[model samples]
Target: MYTNWDDLRLFLAVAREETLSGAGKVLRLDPATVGRRMQRLEAALQATLFAKSPQGYSLTDAGAALLSRAETAERAMRSAIAELPDTTDRLTGQIRIGAPDGSANYLLPQVCAAISDDNPDLDIQIVALPRVFNLSRREADMAIAVSAPTAGRLVVQKITEYHLHLAASEAYLAAHPPIQSASDLKHHRLVGYIPDMIFDRELDYLGDLGITRVPLASNSVSVQINWIRQGGGVGVAHDFSIPAMPGVRRILIDQISLTRAFYLIRHTDDQRNPRLSRFAQALSTGLRAEVARLEGLA
Candidate 1:
């Protein structure tokens, strides 16, 4: 049996991260070193632990069998460390947050970076996507969602109310017709979310634009913003993001601006965990402050 606690720690990191590079980032070691350690662990156990693939590493049956026990060991180690005096301030664990494209691309990098900078021992994974994250399945430790979840054993916190507006690049507007009213949107190249791929109803910005379809569409808000930047078309953009975009300018602010909210979600059980609660509070504070800055309140 492997008796080295350090190697077991590395193994547990790999199991949670599923990639050498990811594990290395958390463990503060080189990816090559992580791989070598994993090899050593596998050799000692005489079993294939991870199935390597282009996507990432997946646990073999042997690895899966050992997972629960390894996790139990990890918990025990944490508990023992916590019992030591003067260790209450130290935090160590993994936290994965899922978010939609808008906040994920533009907002979460800043928020999560600050969190990581403060807590060097914490592993943070930001799963930025357009779909709902299943909290029950443990897909993400927490989520920043466009809407408040009404179902499941999830606790919700209102992060902020953000506004969006119709926006276009200077080059795009120069080549296209003038926008006098909401109805004039039909004459120009409109960019928006793909209807069928629309994951959340709140993301259906085109419906508010009085258009059934757009000339160019994508499921990614970052993609839509990029298309608009390249003069692909006019699209809706978060007001905060528009200020940072060099070429993009807001249009129809009086007639087309809309407000949406972001909610912080976690499983109800997580509310009892101090680490989760503290991190959630930090996230909420950061998001609200950013939103206020975006709204010119800060």
Candidate 2:
């Protein structure tokens, strides 16, 4: 029923701040203007939307009900606005990209630098989180996930695959019993990613072999690697996650290797943006190079 979205915004601001002056400060408007706009909204709604008291203006029953509707309307507007493809020819708009920290750390710099080299006007925003980025709601223009493709209107690429292994500090290895193969691993404390990743349990790489270690776990790959470097028991982290994570040098046995894929992702909405496509290409190329280097498959 709002003829002017501005009125809804003004009402929300006043309701949130509980004072016309506070709302004005946020909206960059004078108190008089804020009050006038809110008053107009209340009059149009034909309800005493707020109670004016010595302390501040407070929402009434009517205002509280309207608040829910107004919030829904605001979210809808924001989603629509967020969906509008950046039509700027110069690639001047900002893009929010979400991905895992490890990928962000190892791969994005070169890709970002490449994007900047091509489109100096482009502004890239990176949001690295442990949680998976949402594509349906546009949480990020793009994402990088560990899992395989899902039933969404998005694009996915098997950007690269990695190998992982059990590793330990030199001192820890020297002090503890030897682990020359999967069978010997059971006898020693080792650095691990906390997955309890036994070769037999997963790849049958250590079939019928029961290996166990500490119960501790870390959400951060780097932290896990650090603990391993400090002689924490056997950890199973990606070779890439391990390089910066701990095991600064080679660790995977010549005969056994753990593997996982890195997928490049983007929402269907972002597919239309030329700059987004460009950025995706750059990231893919960079990922290929990095993966090849890490796996020695180059």
Q: Hey, what RMSD does candidate 1 come out at? A: 5.1
> Which candidate's lDDT is highest?
1
**Model 2, span 12-44: residue lDDT tens:** 788888899988875779999998888788778
Candidates' C-alpha lDDT = 0.84, 0.68
**Which residue pairs show collisions in model 1?**
none
Off by over 4 Å in 2: 1-90, 190-213, 241-247
- Among these predictions, the greatest TM-score belongs to 1
C-alpha root-mean-square deviation, each candidate: 5.1, 8.0
Residue 291, model 2, lDDT: 65
Error of 2 at 194 (Å): 5.5
Question: For candidate 2, which ten residues in a row score worst on lDDT?
Answer: 199-208
